[model samples]
Target chain A: MQTPNTYRAGPDPDGHFGLYGGRYVAETLMPLVLAVEEAYNAANADPAFKAELDYYLKYYVGRPSPLFLAERLTRHFGGAKIYLKREELNHTGAHKINNVLGQVLLARRMGKRRIIAETGAGQHGVATATACALFDLPCVVYMGATDIARQQPNVFRMKLLGAEVVPVHSGTATLKDALNDALRDWVAHVDDTFYVIGTVAGPHPYPAMVRDFQCVIGDETRSQLHEAEGRLPDTLVACIGGGSNAMGLFHPFLDDPSVRMIGVEAGGSGIATGKHAASLNGGLPGVLHGNRTYLLQDDDGQIIDAHSISAGLDYPGIGPEHSWLNDLGRVEYVSITDREALDAFQLCSKLEGIIPALEPAHALAHVAKIAPALPRDHLLVMNMCGRGDKDIFAVADHLGVKL
Target chain B: MRERGYWLALAMSRIEKRFAALKAESRAGLIAYLVAGDPDLDTSTKLFEGVAAAGADLIEIGMPFSDPMADGPVIQAGGLRALQNGMTLRKTLALVRHLRARDADTPYVLMGYYNPIYRYGAEAFAEDAAAAGIDGLIIVDLPPEEERELADPAERAGLDLVRLATPTSDEHRLPTIVKRASGFVYYVAIAGITGTRSADADNVHRAVSQLRRFTDLPIAVGFGIKTPEQAAEVAKAADAAVVGTALVDRLAQNLDSAGKPKPGLVDAVLADIAALASGIRTVRK
Candidate 1:
């Protein structure tokens, strides 16, 4: 096990990600966002706050998840050595709980009584609901009607955790609609509600805050790779929805120029077919849901609805940091179609008994394509963001293997 | 009516004259909905002219946001269709500027959500919308408490912040909603989505009557109003009737067989809108 590296940098001074992010929100919410920023800046510097969070990580949520080297998986793909950061070992079976614990703890310190969030695959909602239950704060989860029907198990878990689940029925009834509803709720109750935004998307503090909490992934991965192989991995890969888990695992490796980082996004069919969620591939520069990122939009700037077998990655926009990283050449984004992700999902499951989430399966698919070309001496670290229990139905339906 | 001098004054003097004429009319005002650019830039100019000529008192040009939440499936589909046909805010504003060259009186209201406007910056958007002959704006997602963000810039640009009020607005909030609203107070008939369907006239009348007691400004009832009879029922109690999804959906439905081109659909929709307005007045009388 390697120690966590705590290095903090950000939004330049005006909450901007290399001209990609700014406080583009209603004025009524600006003061609140500014307050949260100020609070985060103050609390992060506080030794007592850091101690509290560190204690929880060690005792409560079980931090320092294992870094495993997959020998068979690497030889099968015929690519670089594969190392997996086992975030799936975390409580709640995904990387989502890591950030949720951080945000929910921050909400407690801020003296908030109500917590609200939006979820797509219900991973974040369940994580948030778990946090709220632990903290004894009221929790409300807004999920798109479509997602509620798809991710029924997670929805049930949230309800069992005593969170109110509001089904959003507008605009394709998916993640975007749930986001809109959550934003409306925040606006209406800004004074009382601390919106625990699930992903690194939203206006200002959210993207930065979520990234900060998630950056532990990168911090752990960096030290683990250095200790295990006597040097940092040559390449890193992770899936991008709103780019939370990818950013979490990518941030610490950012300054390591030799360690090439790749972010894989879901392409439902193909970019040419115009039915994919490849925001970084097929999208133009635009603002949606508070961040100015690459959005899958038409010529008129109307955001196009996205399609993905993985509900978690079914969004039309990527995180602002990903946009900035793409523009700065710090990261390269690749697309893995539904078929490709399915193939990787099965490959990982059969070879290593590691049933990867549909999201990470996209990254694994990208790795399958690129690994065969890289030298054997080069090592690749892929963030196993979540488990595949939530994706069995989608996989079975897509493969026509009646289960 | 005089309170709205801020946004109304920004309009060219001749255009202001046309707005005044509609204020005097007893015939339930013409409410027009146009997706900023339909067929192309050239077709937008024709659509504006056709609607104006067809007795449209107020034209609500859809400024095409990427994600329009308040819109019904019909309007959302229409907006996507328009966007696919090469419509943009820049092109939409250019259409407004183009319309100003010929007609100035029919009040042009750019309707959409806040993301596109915020992305453009409120001050810059207000300045550009004003320069392009847009008289007012109707951002659907902006709650009443947050109106000041757009209101200050719009006031400076001499454009109205056309706010929306729902049946659920409490007694205390009604006055504030009316206080901030200009041109007219859009009374959402129900507490649901935006679409075209028959609404209970008694329910609409009660909502409008309650709003009428709070503000003397024209209380226009809208949302899901489809037929002429429904329009007449809403018009009998409210000062104006605003129909959106039905007209936009009609254009969407009458598109070219291949779905690529929808030439002359705007004109046909405008004609139907004019008929709806006239039919409402005839039925009410």
Candidate 2:
């Protein structure tokens, strides 16, 4: 248990991040999962794979997105000088493209013909569809029916990219149900298919593979802040659904004991009302979707439906690495409510002239709470993980305004 | 004689007795599967009590979870109906106790995902399930690598921890799978979820033979045996043929428009089981 040497050496060789992650899938997929692991390990060691990923990230995903200081917002907070890592500027308008390119490339290298994925907010779906189109591979995405209704633009986008979007109608028709169907698809088609998991969850290699792909966010932020301020930032913050963007930003800074990290979860209405997506704050450890993590479930362990205004953040479980980091006290996990995120969404748009995604607005809400209390010299950076174009309809519906 | 001594030490578990009886009969067995509390608790209980009488050599009761990812549409709907009717792990165990009070010869295994048992407290669940007369467990989600917590507790309670060997399981992984398995090796005849496709007779034959090379336990072929023909084909390849989706489909066919069981649901399912049993009896391993 003590051999982490660093907070990043994790997942061990067997894909365990200290009991939080293991392959809990059915025996029918165990060999396939191991085969994927073997392929990923080989590709990870190959210089050509690294160079190819770098080429795609730099050209396709538009890597090294700007880290701009929000002067007006910082002055409004009157405390920490807030900076935003503008991941929303990336291709497909989210940090999800980072992982998509990495996974799709790996799928091709494994000689897989079809690509499959599951989506919650449609951002990952759109990203995967785009990558599959670029590679000219047949792609299928499983989305919850409720999500397709809310995130309609992304559905259209995926269809336009020549990807099939299948709506899952089971179990509250949400992200977890989409995941269940995607996994079922994998089991049925493991011979020629690859599953492009969007977030830092599911069974590892996935949690670790996704984190490594998205680590560009943190790696860039670290050097950018040092070049500007001559030292490490005091704090890093990001919103978490399955905790990919947060993991991306925090994993690079985990060994820096001087820096603090916070992952904000969605508090739909309130945690006490049993309607929130705050797994770490209000749930218990259990296995779901092939990994052990904090899951929102009843006493009988039936996965409870998660509620959030931001569909991206409405998952019942966090990434296993996030759960492990919470256990190690490496990153502080907190929750923000719908009203708080909505307010932050509007405030960030007006103050910084940046319309942020509802997912990152949760992180901004937490920043609003703490930034005012910190010293003026304190530096804080938050990941603006996605844009708000796909969310305007939901935002208007919540605002009681006709779109 | 040596196997009987081994059974004597464990008080002759029902699973062992059932397998021994099937061996003596020199024909493949039939396992009738049902989701506990489907449609309603009473109907499920009636069907549970009727399977053995109707000719089921073994019974498998599904402990319904909200998300049964490993099941096809029929069994998934069956589980949903059971969950809607207020079936929990506790209630399923109570049904087991009920089955034990009346019949002691028919061995039954509980099939489900691992979350419910993990939530029920694995140690407590194993002891409670064993006490309630459950013979074995086919937890689809908990592979051998992750079964240590529940396996130890289940073993201490004298429950058989059954393992599933799928078409995807290669020679290297077979040892790890059989090393921890106790009751029998469930050979998933296809590399897919339950009840979706029919197993190829040739593939089942080869896979069953391959499994025997490593494990001395009886082999049960499942996961796509939907018809009497398919069941008969699997019976020729393995020790038993498990027909879950077919029986569940029969129950579904008897249900009314609103998903409530009609008057003859029990009889229809039992008849289906009897038909499968007859078909399996036509073939010998």
Candidate 3:
């Protein structure tokens, strides 16, 4: 088995982390993909690009988000010192802003006039629209009709940001369908459009580029934890949908073998009931989107609709880096059911005065499971990736609350 | 497994024979595409035979996927309708078998994304597809970089893994694409999904002329050849004009309000095919 240090150097020159990430697209989009790859590589090497990104992240999106010690939750667990990486405090109320800001800037640098993206939970859509609004670029977001109906606030939010939200109705009408629509749009308008894939999935350069952008979460967490606790945390936890937040937090800690990482997946109902979005936990390795990774697909390779109370985690496939890490056993992956996540959602609200989004609720649910068993001296940090404002209606409906 | 030369030789024989026949007649071939179980299997099967009888030289059967990222709304709807009516990879191959049972001369190619074949097991899919008389394949999402997964098995089964060269496939990438490409080269005239925009004939001619410098394989121009006029214009530049979304659109146009196939659906599809075939046949002269 490869050590954590060896795993950090992926996805190589061909954009592959073992057999996971590569450019699996049509011929018409090849040149555009290549151009994006070249531009990203040059920007990655340019110090001016990094300086501009740092400037925006610090002043605009409010980077270096706090790492707060959840004292009440720590007392409740009574086993480990619990700390929360407060990504929910960011401008877009989620870790998604970190990636969108970087991608929109890169798109502008490449002279791309239009920006396109796919969103499931509307957080990424809101963040992408926010960046486009700030950059004065035309933006279009493809969202599933089902998602649009459920996430009406984010829909209106995107429209308010001057983005045209196209509701895709084909093929299960979810994140996968929305992604398919976005790819079709990119293919149709390859000349002037830049597809800002929300997650760390998709073709070459995406898994890597999105990971690079999101590493800010882990980078800040590492420094912040050192300043607060005088040492690295013993354990790290984050939720995984297409696994952007998890990758963001885990990439910086990969080389630190002393810090164990756990990725929590949305186990809607349960894995046994076949109604969950636990791609790494329940799915098999297959090709989807633009990369080879773990996917929820049937015997005929047709992608199955993933079920999760949180639309953000309701995707059939995961990022290739997550797939590679799962294979390497560097990061442990587990599932938390909807009922458990709901319980954690309320627990964090009352105990820590934090109403986390349903996505991070999954991570809190997993924290509830193991936090009580560890030693009090042991330290655990969880990514509070999003706030619960957008999910209040869904949670209320699930809990049968009249409000 | 047969040697590379052996597989290439056998793969070219059938496809080359069709193109050679078209060349001798001083005209281009009209390739028609249809979702295997659009609306339903029986109607799609009827449309398949009707297209061949209506003068289409080659048939491209679309194996509908649940998620077709490379397709536009029209073809995406067609696939959804097919899946709703019970379209599976196994059923699609069976449809090809049924078509090949009576008509043995025309060439048949299976085109779609790779997930279904990967799910069916690549080796088994190759065996079944070849046994069902599939001559070539054009997996839209599987590029040359990721071809090893299915290409080797398909070629071993004597099925041509027909590769696509697009408007964006620049001079540097064309060699790698045409290297393992068999049967013929599918030149996507537009840099977009199916049925969106028309391809300029001048650009199509220039691309085909450029591609001719790399390989001897017959080139087929597709994607946005919607009208008979557009098909005829494309045929003047390429060996074949492949039309898919236009045919799918005709199927959609003749559908009832409930999304069921109307009575004139087959007639409408066949009429469109006949018109396109006529336009393509008269192109060179």
Candidate 4:
């Protein structure tokens, strides 16, 4: 019933991406959300703001991260040529810094002295803490109690950067609970605190604003691929949790009909077993964290805890824009189980000497499946969005390595 | 137009009547909230009846969710207990119907998040809730901007959808909220979650006065009016004062070491309600 181009311009003035995204929060947060919308709009149009963002992205966070050709991976697949967009080389060792720098600058411009964020794997928390330290702003990061225990290194990283890491014990003690606590903190301290939402989710201005900040990945990839391959790649792949990295890599290429987009979701044990974080593949659309998105919930509409070996992908919901994209048929969403992701983690490490995070290992698993069936001339770009240094202990434990 | 007016009047009459009676007595109405199946359903039902008998002008039954973001630890624990006791949306409506059979005059509001009703199907939920004699609803997560998903159906079913106004709701946004809001305006006395901090009476009075300038809708102050003294302070300015966490805490306090209801759990909660009711009544004296 709709054209292919219908997916390009979404999230109308009211922030509804075809009934998926809207500001579904309490009245206590309405004014603050509106203020953020206004400030983001003004900053978006100001050339000076863009220039400053560019400066930080290039000098501080290290932009234009190399597009490394994974020749061994291509040979192992025995099909398409594979290229890895090395976002793992960024300052914070992940793609999270790209958006954090932009948001911290915007928060500074708005005269906010305190920064608060919620994290699952500690990658976003580390990135946000890094930005806050650079900007001289006091920072607080909320992490789940379970995550704090599992992700001790990230907890230490946040503390080393002078940010307080509060362990949330409410609900399932996961990313969703952490986000709820952060929103509560924001509501209580709206006057002085800026909530740096880690993903491309949350209410209006958040999903869109975060995507705009992250689209640099796709923007760079378009030119880099053209210069290297003489044309756009046939397919793009990235893992989806709150879906920031996937949205970043998918937004600028939405209009390129020749380039297909595939978002990989963590299937945990498996989608069939019901213990998974594959929101689009195994869940339904419902409201949570201030927006309507695909959420893992019971039949009674109570949210269920998402399970994944990777902390970053252990979230019950995905981004609202991903919901819109899935509904519009512009992007294909698939799932990979925990076993498959772990296998890919080892395979990628052995084949390319690139230790991919469990989050992107889901994407690698899917790529391994589909790439082998495609023609050799076909080009596939997968976002190596995060490094696996933080995941070594978990992976080792799972593999009986006794790290 | 006349039919619309009739529906609006009929939908609003229960809330209006309670406020009118309180006005005649020169006191604020007491709104009591209880999780539907705290500890167990039959006990919560008994507690609800006791609250009405103890002089609560209106009642709010919380449909417990897995995650209650707006609630404090006391209320969240109550919700978890209710869920563990097998409290579901259908059972909550059944509980309301049972209560309605006993007392028909008290305004009953179902307060919680929106997902349960969304899963129940909005139109079906409205029909069933209206059939169950539910007077109103206060979904904490469904703001005015996203109300149409449930508001239109609720209105057609002759159920009032109350809106919450907080300290952050400035003058620029009050008009839009007041226009569509029915039943009453729930003013969160504190900027924080339920039961965290008590509201300053003077600040509450100023906020209520500001809201009064926009709409004639009765203002019911909630969120941190925990004790009798706090309720008395809020009663001076607001038409009604809502108490949730204090009553929930009473139920928790009366429980045994194993979390089971002790002998006087219902009585203890009712006695607290009676004290709060008497406290609000002192605004007249």
Candidate 5:
């Protein structure tokens, strides 16, 4: 397991992902944000904090999820050998729990009594609620009114765990709106509330801290692939929402010169057609949701609404680190249109006998386009970050077919 | 009939008087907001001069937040422009420090949301804001309940804490909110969010009259006091009118193709603001 110190937030005082990520929030949340940064700084170094999080990740969260070789899918594609980091098998059924467990434990250590989270797809909300239940802490999840209806099952799961889900009706009533509501709630209750932000975004320490916790997925993937294939993977692929799951799988492989990391974004219609959440493909450097990142914003800098079949991926901003990676040329972001993602969802299910969450299905869909051109001897690893069980209705509706 | 600095001079006079009696004034005072570093800080500086000239009472140099929930699109766009122009809280405070050098009597208020203040530590912020010539603070998000952490330190620095009282505040909470407030009470009227227009003038008059019963403190109503007509309706009951989103919206309109402030826009907005202030007179018994 990687040491907790491996992902320390600060050392970059200006909040940069190697010259990106700065405090871009409203002036109201600054002091609390500073407090959070200070708290994370002190807590990340404490042995007790490290040990407690390790216990949950191993015993409670059931981490170090297997990296399985998708041999048949690789053969069918006739390109690079495909490997899957099975985060879908993790407790709470996604890579989100890995982060929630880490944050909840940090919250307990900080002596914070309440947890607040914002969810678009509700995976983070469910994960936060689960952690709150385990620790007997009060939890409040802010979900966009639109998401409350679309991601109802996860909303139900959060409620079943005794978390109160607040429906945010402001602005487009989606992930960004939920984030606005969560910030409001945190500002209202900053004294005792620990905001368990679900992604690799937000101000300093959060982006860095969440990535550190989630890097387990990457660390495990690297070792598991090495054990299976006797070498590092030639290509790594993951979907980008706030880019958390992608960061988890990409962090360890970041320094590997031979590895080509690909981030697939939701191109609702297509980037060329202009209705998409493909920030890296079609975005400018702008400030939003706490950091300076690649954002889908207008020339005047008003954040543009994003569209994706997957509610999780329908955010106009990508993680600040992803912005830096894009700038550094370490990662290339590709867009997979809604039609392509939906087709990939069916193809993966039929050929691999695995139904991928629509978010990751975007990345899988990219492989269908990029893989055939690569040599068969090379290896490509895709993070099967979540399960599609939560997305059946959405995929069905998109196809105009009954579930 | 008026010189460029004529309106500018009126804004300066008000800023001077407000700070001179800040500590002694028992009736909570009014702090007027105009986006700092807006329309080029030169004009913003002149606008501050105009605010001082106009007997603004107290000055709240708004450090604009990008997503101003309570603000209408006009103010929201104004704030975005301010940020785009490289207007940071540090720079806004620096402008106040610049003002302090010329006229030391008028108290400056740094009114904004929390993010920028958080970036600078609250305790350290109080000290720095005081050093920068800011004499009061009104953070919209920091209510009485969340005051101990920020308000206590600010008060120690001799800066006043101006809290808001919305229409939704109940009788029990109103008094408590009033008791804790160090400066004038801000009464937000007909809020769904911000920047939207108020349909009725009479409703605003009635709301202001209702607020007067709670405290002897100066009560100002904001949220939709846009035009001179609206200000006149509010002036009947309220001690001062808060014209924010309206002023900000004007500046946003004046922005050029590159989003920079056009000088023509500044002059035009100042003319409108002058007309609005001149239109409303303090109500007589």
Candidate 6:
């Protein structure tokens, strides 16, 4: 496949980002999926849709999330300047709400009466539930039973937000099964329900649509960095599970040849230990959850269970566009161990006075490694995608505390 | 100019041959479906023979996948049971070869998602499946738009790539779906997954009549077929009625505490298939 002159012109009319993404759903949902593509494209062209989304994002979602200089962390590393895109400070405490509001608005525009979503750590579920509450739509969230147990607070948050949380006890009872259950629900209720896929994954129109909604993060960073540093940043880093946050941050800078970008995957233990969620590092290209991407699957094409300390990163496959970009060698894909992320979590909490979620801590861990090697003038940005308030219990338990 | 649908009527694939024969006999076919290695290899192995002997005109063997979102809870459990019993695509193909060693006349269609076959390498899988005496394939997730991945290889290997026409397939989408499909089209009786709702007879009649306008391929109705009466209703308008979850549920009822099949498990499942066959045979389509 010939590389396009511009990196952003992807996911052609049939939803193929160079054979990595397509609608691989059952025939019962094919028309609905196609309708979603049509609806999203129409929504993109309408100024009213953008104005409504901007209105909600600025007021309800609290957009334009600040980009702060981590001066103490930079001093600790004693190398290149470091900046944190404080997505954790947003309403619902993560970057998930940005895409949720956009999708819920699209659903409303299409006259869908119900909202459904799948979540691993419940961040997306909470975000969806909050948006549904604001929009007065009935929300259904499918979460793995195991995730419900581990992330009790976020599950409770979703319930309090008036969403019915269905626990999926299917194979492995994790994010993949939750995704399976969500797709099943969508197939069953295609007429009234609109499925708000959490990340930059799923059947077409979703990866592209979600990334377009999330480009605000990178778009802000580009102009914000230029204002602060008077030039484009040298390097960009963010962790990936289904890879929405990283895609949002990396996509805006993809054409800038001088800006080096890296996607940090969750190496649960380490690659050598054979227990990790690093799809790009230890997996191959395959199909799962409606898209063909890099998946952790066995020899017989059965999806293998992915492991990570961060529940948000506990998915067997990465998004299709990420897989395509990885193939194009446009963005560097790497891994960070759980132990490294844990240390980085504590270091950011102590030095920067802002605790980070375990998901972004993986990106911060990568930042810690490369920060010391560069000169002081080199600007680096890491997406602080979520706060650690929801992760305190898990972190405390991991540290042998009686939390 | 000769129309494309005219050429579609001339192709006599193996499964199509069985449907035509059933039509000539003035009886709609009973297409029984079961996971390849449900419960255990011994029990599922017995089931392949039992259903064939129970007067099932055509058979649809489900290849178990870890995430079968298109199926309901009962079929999902059945697939999980088969996978737990160490069933893989290669093992399922081996099971088909085993079935062929005894009964070569029964038309077999391997039905499942696409990932497993993709992992086995599509070309090798197509050739191997044809060699194993499998007649057709119904990959639930491989839509017509994405047929380029497996279409050529399945054609090269002489295996019928059966297409599923659902209620969600609009008029504009109907021609595109059946244009490339070789075997009898499997018309899903309902918009939902398998075993959830009893397919409304009026809806099935309407959907089947609409499908008749597109192509001459024999239509086999499946999904939401729970009872012999429901099977008979579906068979009245379509060429065949596929009863899967009802039979899988009966098989599940006969399993012992240890997940093994009990003494009469094989006979019970075969008897249900025979009951459904008799029901479909009662209807003159």
Candidate 6 CA-lDDT value: 0.92
Residue B231 in candidate 6, Cα distance off native in Å: 0.9
lDDT of each: 0.79, 0.92, 0.92, 0.92, 0.76, 0.92
User: Candidate 1: misplaced stretches above 4 Å?
Assistant: A1-8, B1-60, B69-109, B113-132, B135-285
How much lDDT does candidate 4 score? 0.92
Off by over 4 Å in 4: B1-12
- Whole-model alpha-carbon lDDT for candidate 1: 0.79
* lDDT score of residue A32 within candidate 2: 81
RMSD (Cα, Å) for all candidates, in order, is 7.9, 1.7, 2.9, 2.3, 11.1, 2.9
Tens-place lDDT per residue, model 2, B86-174, is 99999999999999999977898999999999999999999999999999999999998789999999999999999999988889999
The predicted structure with the larger TM-score, 1 or 3, is 3
Clashing pairs in 4: none
The residue pairs in collision within model 1 are: A79-A371, A303-B66, B7-B158, B7-B159, B15-B104
What's model 5's overall lDDT? Answer: 0.76
Q: Which pairs clash in the backbone of model 3?
A: none
Residues A51-117, candidate 2: write the lDDT tens digits.
9999988988888899999999999999999999999999999999999999999999999999999
lDDT of 5 by residue, A1-403 (tens): 2222333343277566654576655333555676777778787888888888888888887878988888778888898788888898888888999999988887887789999999999888989999999999999999999988888788888899999999977677899878876876665565788989999998777888889889999898878887887888899999999999999888887777788999999999999778999898988776566676787866434567889999989998988888877876778898999999999899889988899999989999998888888998888989999899889888888788986
Worst lDDT 10-window in candidate 3 chain A = A1-10
TM-score against truth, every candidate: 0.72, 0.98, 0.96, 0.98, 0.68, 0.97
Show where candidate 5 strays beyond 4 Å: A1-11, A26-28, B1-29, B32-66, B69-285
lDDT of 6 by residue, A1-403 (tens): 5667988989888888896999888888888889999999999999999999999989887889888999999999999899999999889999999999999999999999999999999999999999999989999999999999889999999999999999999888999999999999988887899999999998888999999999999999999998888999999999999999999999999999999999999999998787999999999888888888899988999888999999999999999999999998899999999999999999999999999999999999999999999999999999999999889999898899996
Error of 1 at B58 (Å): 7.7
- Please, what are the lDDT tens digits per residue for candidate 1 over residues B1-285? 657766666653433454355456655565767677664556556667788677666788987765765555677677766766777788888888888778756778888876667666779889999998888888775655445668999989889787677755657667766777676777777555568345678888788778788877667777868877778777778766778788877776777777744666766787788777776666432
DockQ in order: 0.13, 0.85, 0.76, 0.76, 0.06, 0.76
